[model samples]
Target: MVYVNNVGQAIMQVDRWTTLAPGQARNSVRIESYAVFNKGLFILDVEAAPWGCGVWPAWWTVGPNWPWGGEIDILEGVHDNVHNAMTFHTQPGCSLPTPNPKTSLGPNSTGWIESTDCNAFANSNSGCQTVDTSQASYGTQFNVLKGGVFAMMWADDGIRIWFFHRAAIPEDLQENAPQPNNWGTPVAFLHNTLCPTSKIFYDHQMIFDITFCGDWAGTSYISSGCPGTCSQRVMTPSNFANASWTINSLQVYRSPQISGASLALPRPRSLMYLSAGLILLLLYI
Candidate 1:
């Protein structure tokens, strides 16, 4: 839906009012951006999110192929859970290093990593992931607080994600100037130097989807012990009243001018220097 809210900003949502009966199946909503991006920054402000049994809503990015390409799940969860998780999916040869004792985290650095292997083909496709420690970061609690802003800074240095409460949105963002360096420690930080992003990851298209009774949500729906089959809970209407999303917009920012030289320049002491040295050595011999 499209309408102007009291705040006078345009809004779009996937607020389904009804539900399917037992054995009924409905294709969930999925919005994928056509543009492909590699290195950039993104900030998405959501007014509400889908949070209920058997509902798997996520805002993420994925490449064309499966494990060979890559995927970055910025937000994902199953059932009526409140905690939020971030995951990185790739092929083999990509793994994360455990944080050392010397590493210090700020107040916002409360994320707990579940797995260190980013390879989707490995670990049963669990991927390298981390969960947010903030209660007001997702699901029921997040809506109760009137939703919030999620910022992702993707660079060769590392991939970092930050959460800012609706009320805590920085003035800089409001003014359209986002300075991530000034922001506090991210809720999720995956160091990519070891994985070498270019090697395991590739161009991706943005995606926002809410699927029901599939892999993550369906297979694990019973883990919450909801007292029924995954499809049973999913088909019930009352179970999905809260399964929706009220989104403002997604903003992707990148450098206006390309950095570095467009063409490669020869080194000061390149192959020519080596050739000259080899000739001199042969003369001495």
Candidate 2:
């Protein structure tokens, strides 16, 4: 996938990859690649994201079963809101706490709930949760009009993530790793029984890209309240025209490391001599 701004261009491309059509929405796209499932890695870098009510910009991954398979939401939020959330969609056993203390779910609080129990907010949407930012700690203190980085890593054990502000991106991440901080804070979402086998659990590849507006952010009545959808509440035509979710670039590398050993045949004489020596030793014995 590729995005071009008036200044230049940003591209998201992968070998042996698949792209899905926009789903029931105007500004969204989906890309899939089972090849990277248990082999390599996938990285996404979003440029400037659109902020408005009914606007959903996401970078996430899912497994076979819906709630059972597990969902990892790297970056997801309504436009112009301060708190962008990192969530995991899983079975009953893997629910996360509201206002995650470890990651500082924050001061102003909208609590957490189980996937099966979030029905009150489900006005027809499948997986819906209400998070109030002014009440939450993170967004309450800052201005979210500007875009940032969001990222996730699906590995052998569990998912790991990091969210960085544009200025806070580590030098190492900027030079070597894809910069997720530019979009938002990175968080890992996990699911129970998503991977029945240990071999396949952490083996699947991850994808990174941006969706304009869809299920989560584009929900009906999203622009009503104080901590309502960011896109609906915050975006202006001027900013929407000038600002956009821009992806700089993406790169994938084997964690630990990829073996570099080469396979070559031994010289015939070397093999023959070794074999003859073994035969002579056997005879002597």
Candidate 3:
């Protein structure tokens, strides 16, 4: 279910009123950028995000070949999480240093470090993670603030993520001159000192997806305090009324020195929208 609103915003939504069979998966949307990028500043202005039980929503970037090429999870969380989790998935050897100089634990950021090892095979593929402490960073609280901008700066040195509430957006960003240095304390930072981003991350495409009862969500469904099982929730049609993404815009600004593909706004015809009306059910298996 993908449609454009009267104001030109894209509304990628999940099926909210369809009762499914015992083994059926609910329909949802997962869209990706038309072009792959090497390095740039990407900003996503979101009006609403999918929330509630049995849903996992994320806005992230991924290189080729699973974890070998690296994956950067800029905005991600499952179920009724209040804070967004920023994570990095890479091959073994790339790790976030303890007492990281660029995380919330560091003097330069505001997100608390969750895991330091970025290896996709370690800790149930948890990756290196940092969690935003702000109550308005994810889920229902975020929508109450009418959403905001999630800015990601990917450079040769490192990657940094910042979330600005609708009322506190930086003036420079509004003026189209994004000076990340002037923005104080990012919510998440992955430096290159220990994690060789150049080798681990490359040719990444941006992604937005809403999946239900998958690995992350299904595995922790009971613990999330949702009623009944995750599969049972899928059969209940009313569990997904708010499971949608109302995106105002996604803007990408590339540096002349970055030596990557030219960044262009997604034209309506060029955008690839995928809405699986009959997706395979994925449980804790």
Output the number of the TM-score-best candidate: 3
List the lowest-lDDT window of 10 residues for candidate 2.
Answer: 260-269
For model 2, the stretches where C-alpha displacement exceeds 4 angstroms are 5-8, 11-28, 33-35, 39-43, 97-146, 177-215, 218-244, 256-285
Best by lDDT: 3
Clashes of each: 0, 37, 0
Q: Give all candidates' CA lDDT scores.
A: 0.69, 0.39, 0.79
Provide the clash count, candidate 1.
0
- 1-285 in candidate 3: lDDT tens per residue? 776667777788898878999979888888776577777788777889898899999999999788878999988888899999999999998877565555437445688888889999999999988889898799999999999989887877778889999999988766655667677778877878888888889989778899998889999999999999999998877999888988876667765443212222222213222222211111001
| lDDT of candidate 2 at residue 275, scale 0 to 100 | 22
Give all candidate RMSDs, comma-separated. 14.4, 15.7, 6.3
Q: Residues 1-48, candidate 1, lDDT per residue (tens digit)?
A: 334466544333344555776687764567666567775677777778
Q: Across residues 86-184, which tens digit of lDDT does each residue of candidate 2 receive?
A: 555544443333445453442222323223221222334244232323322123222242333444445443444555555655664565433322433
Candidate 1 accuracy as TM-score: 0.81
Candidate 1 at 167: error in angstroms? Answer: 2.1
Stretch of 10 with least lDDT, candidate 1:
265-274
- Model 3: CA > 4 A from native: 99-104, 258-285
